[model samples]
Target: MGSLFEELEAREATARKRVEALEAEVAEVSGRLSAAREGLERLRIARETVAEVLAEMTPEKPGVAVDTDRSSAVDSVASAYAGAERHVIGVLTVPNWQPGMGAEVLPRVYRDILEVVTDARGPVRAKQIVPRIGLPAEAGKIEGTRSKLKRLVERGWLDEDTPGMFTPARRRGGASPNSR
Candidate 1:
């Protein structure tokens, strides 16, 4: 009787493990289903976008000519937007700064780095900035600074004129560290 009871207990434990595994599988299937639903939504959006674009380009009436004026207007708007974007230094607002303090939102090292680069009248290299920013001559520090500068360019805080050369991005109203 004792041996029989032990066998039943072991079987129960095994059953429990099997049930847990099945539950895990169910959860995985649920996640996959969710992802499939999201993909379907994206497909729907894409289809709608293509339909809208086709409608715009196609003539609504059988004999109507494609609207040249509408096409020209679109072109004008695109060029104007591009010109405006190119003229502005960065997309972000230029926060007011106390000459030496830099922007409050930036890290101390970043402010130091920006100050050095902007103080240079023209585009400066990462090598040039490292010393002025007081970073050590180690290769790691130099590379790190270079990466930071690149990121700054991406964030619209700085501009890259040449490979590895950086300059201050102009503010929306033409104000910048140099202008100030």
Candidate 2:
């Protein structure tokens, strides 16, 4: 009986040590995951910044090649391709609204946002629009949504009459171009 008790105690100690090792591993993995997510977010922001800068500098003519000295020609080519197939593909930033432009030309998140504002039929705030677009009603998400709304306003896809309140930009026909 004494020997059996000692064996059981030894087994329990081994199991506890394994659990502690697993816990340590989980902590290490969680830290790595957080770092990876942060790096990914930084990359996303860098990409968006580059896209915005390129869009501003790019000429409307298709034959004009972007200056490859400042940036990769592949990005310019991809942007041109994206512009050509924008109605079918998603763009990283909102394009300058054209007369016949529709919500389909925008990315899925932007389209969802536009739809939410149009459906609201009045000015809506970022917090109000966030959950409607299937985002969690968190401060970070609300701020991100707000930034997107401001981008839409800048691109003439939406309007902000009051600070923090967004509405679809009005067309000559009293309907939003996004409605089409």
Candidate 3:
């Protein structure tokens, strides 16, 4: 009986030591995982910044060859692109609506925009359009949406009744020029 009791005590001591070692390992791994998550978050923010900068950069005469010493021109273009990128990032982080995507989500941005503009008897401004579309009243968001509205007008989907005001193109009694 004395020998058996001693064997059980030795086994309990080994088990306790294993539990302590596992606790130490768990702490180390948790610290590493936390550091990795922070690094990943930093990388994600960097990626978004690069994407915004790229979005604002445009090739001057995309496929055309430069015929002169364009150092000054290149500098100007870079500066302009940087300014545009900052402006866009400061205000709106949203992308413009793509008309080709079929209805898939509830209260779509493009459809809501049309509904807001058409529901009014006349031209609509960004002030009126912003809330209807469910975006925050940020300067960048408002201006970005306004810009999108202008493009839709150029594409024959809507008409600009006046500067910064919008109306549906169909009110003029014709199909969109680009529509099939």
Q: Which candidate leads the pack in lDDT?
A: 2
Residue-wise C-alpha lDDT for candidate 3, range 4-56, written one tens digit per residue? 99999999999999999999999999999999998997887576556444433
Per-candidate Cα RMSD to the true structure, in Å, reads 14.2, 7.1, 11.3
Which is the better candidate, 1 or 3, if ranked by TM-score? 3
lDDT tens digits by residue: candidate 1, 26-99: 99999999999989978875754443333233344332222335455344434435654433222222223323
Each prediction's whole-model lDDT (CA):
0.63, 0.75, 0.61
Residues forming the 10-long window of minimal summed lDDT in candidate 2: 84-93
Give the least accurate 10-residue stretch of model 1, judged by summed lDDT: 86-95
Of candidate 3, the 10-residue stretch with the lowest lDDT total is 88-97
Model 1: per-residue Cα lDDT at residue 146: 86
Quickly count the clashes in candidate 2: 0
Clashing pairs in 3: none
lDDT of 1: 0.63
Better of 1 and 2 by lDDT: 2
TM-score of 3: 0.41
The TM-scores of all predictions, comma-separated, are 0.39, 0.67, 0.41
